[model samples]
Target: MRLNKTQYVALHLLMIFTFPSYPPYLIVAYYKPELVACSIPSAFQGQAQIKWSKAMITVNVLTIIPYALTALIIRSRKTSSFSRRLFRSLLLVMIFDVGSWLAAVSFIKLL
Candidate 1:
């Protein structure tokens, strides 16, 4: 399905809340842990926070493999009713991807 301008806008806004995968933040968290505590809620002030933050981001980075592959398949294929169905399924996958990683992050915070 070809997305019209409005549909694209709506999809974008909807995706915005899905805990964005920002590489720069992960970089700062890895190289300069103190700096990220203010920006990253789970990253508090401590040496352990640095390790946990890096591990959480690492898991998040790994999860992107699946998300990217699904996205590439969707984009490489022609838009059609089938693609729309795939897009819908992709949204579900996206939700699960982000949710699972965040859950893992939360779990790590407890450790």
Candidate 2:
């Protein structure tokens, strides 16, 4: 699959947005439940909490939108080479997402 420049950028952006801090968040939630839970209600917990949550939601949503769009683009039986490459790239992103999540879970469990 030969991804065009736009598709390559899109896929890289999706991967960046999806997985960067996800594992750390998962680990924190697992190991520091009280702190994570309290931060949600503690308005004065400072700007970091607010910023992190906002970024997390925005990036996750952005990642999902592209993947869904790619799926639809592929399912429509579009025959463009670029679309095919985009579809394959999106599939790899999906796989990487799952693998990252699993690795996070395993690491948390091992601790």
Candidate 3:
């Protein structure tokens, strides 16, 4: 099944709004332990900060690029079985993406 232009536009809009912005925030929370009230010993904090920053940057780039590409593909006029499958996969990914962020945020708040 192929989506109409309006559906395409709507999907892209939804994706733009729903994509995760948590990796950067996670990076901050991990590095600035004060933000999340982490009580780690001072000796390892510097190493932890470096590791978190690197991991966050890597994951953020990885997640964001595919997200942008998926949005672009959804917006295009090309309709094929592959595109449909890709669109469904993207939708599922977005669902998981949003769910994961919400879960993490709640978990952090509870900590």
Of the candidates shown, which would achieve the greatest lDDT relative to the real structure?
Answer: 1
**TM per model?**
0.35, 0.36, 0.37
- Candidates by lDDT, descending order: 1, 2, 3
- Model 3: residue 57 alpha-carbon error in angstroms: 6.4
Q: Judged by lDDT against the true structure, how good is candidate 3?
A: 0.60
Query: lDDT per prediction?
Result: 0.64, 0.61, 0.60
lDDT of 1 by residue, 1-111 (tens): 899999999987876654354434454554543444234544444554565567657766776787777777777886687876877787787778778767866876576
* Candidate 3 lDDT trough over 10 residues, lowest sum: 35-44
lDDT of 3 by residue, 13-100 (tens): 9866654454444445556434335432221244554554455446555666777786676678667778778778877776688667
Candidate 1, superposed: residue stretches over 4 Å from native: 1-45, 79-83, 86-89, 92-111
| CA RMSD per model (angstroms) | 11.0, 10.5, 12.4
Model 2, backbone clash pairs (residues 3+ apart or across chains), number: 0
- Residue lDDT tens for model 2, 18-111: 7766545644553432443332323223444455546655665566777778688677976788878877887787768856754653554355
lDDT pick, better of 1 and 3:
1
Which 10-residue span in candidate 1 carries the lowest summed lDDT? 32-41
